[model samples]
Target: MCSNGWIRAHATYYGVNDSPASLGGACGYDNPYHAGFGAHTAALSGALFRNGESCGGCYQVRCDYWADPKWCLRGAAVTVTATNFCPSNNNGGWCNLPRHHFDMSMPAFFRIARRGNEGIVPVFYRRVGCKRRGGVRFTMRGQGNFNMVILSNVGGSGAVKAGAVRGSRGKTWRQMTRNWGANWQSSGDLRGQRLSFRVTLLDRKTMTFLNVVPSSWWFGQTFSGRGQFL
Candidate 1:
């Protein structure tokens, strides 16, 4: 377990009582509800946030004792997904912590920390392969002549660094712009054509899916790709 990459940090929570739409942060995720939960999501500070590049990345965190010796998890750890950013302005300067800090959800923090300890706990964390249940999903979100696609449920590296699209009859791959979050947009019309995508993970790994979107595909539709980044 110590062989993988890891970081030391402090943990905290947000949206503990009610879920906010912005829980998806700047990633434009279609599943804000899950992002709002403490069990599966976390917020990273500016350093670890990687300018949103860490979106969808997964990590396993174990609490380290700093204050009261009475509350300690010993070595318990919990896994969480990168779903939001923890701005430096929050809560007295904890978020302003070094690049290694993490502001986790209550459920995630509780899972590693003892029953109570002023809500702040030191932790040892490391990036881990995201465990997705099925194939990756591409959700279409544009008008008739334009295309804005959101990539989600990606396994492994999680966030996408670059992406391209090609029409059923086209030979060249058209680059897509990272509009925000996981949403990528094409500059031209892609109507009447089945669509394929090529994605580059943050780690520089690449994957291409042919005809993942059928010619009959419409705006707001979602299609499942047969493969995922390992």
Candidate 2:
């Protein structure tokens, strides 16, 4: 403990899968996972605010909503949630409830050949329009800096938006993040090739963002990669 009486803690955690079933009591326990990597660091420690658990709000008292054009009001000084893990109507209660989108697809034959064959691997980006459902959590790690994650999108003109998703608020602790991204990971049958994208909500001050979903092409192209599209 420091002279100020603030106690510090450190620990390590392992095991690949960190699911809600595993972390039940903790706040924002479901869909617990690491950003890109770091099984131990993610479980070690950081800052934890449960789903719907908030200290008043991320804002002070009087602030403007700059994250969205619809969010207009000089209400409370809260962090205009560009991304939210709390069980909130992120789109403001039905006004906006759409999954993060990324549009990209290849013929089923080509998709299979790409993942299964591996010889002709096609690498591209798909923009993640938004988060899937509320509780679209974020698992962050590291202390010295923010955990980096890239959100690749496939644009019409064939452009890739490269960026990283980070958890900056929780930096002091060794590493900790407890968010539940329930609807973020879902796969089912589609009409044609599932061309989708993954959006990584990043700090513009540090990272970038992208979109996913449109024709739903790459949804089933590869269970290995697409499975973790969340």
**Winning model by lDDT:** 1
Candidate 1, 142-184: lDDT as tens digits: 8866789988888878878999999987899999988876789
lDDT of each: 0.76, 0.21
Off by over 4 Å in 1: 1-4, 19-22, 32-38, 66-68, 97-99
- What TM-score should be assigned to candidate 2? 0.22
**Consecutive 10-residue window with the lowest summed lDDT within model 1:** 30-39
lDDT tens per residue, model 2, 102-146 = 111112112212223322221111112221222222222222222
Candidate 2 lDDT score relative to the true structure: 0.21
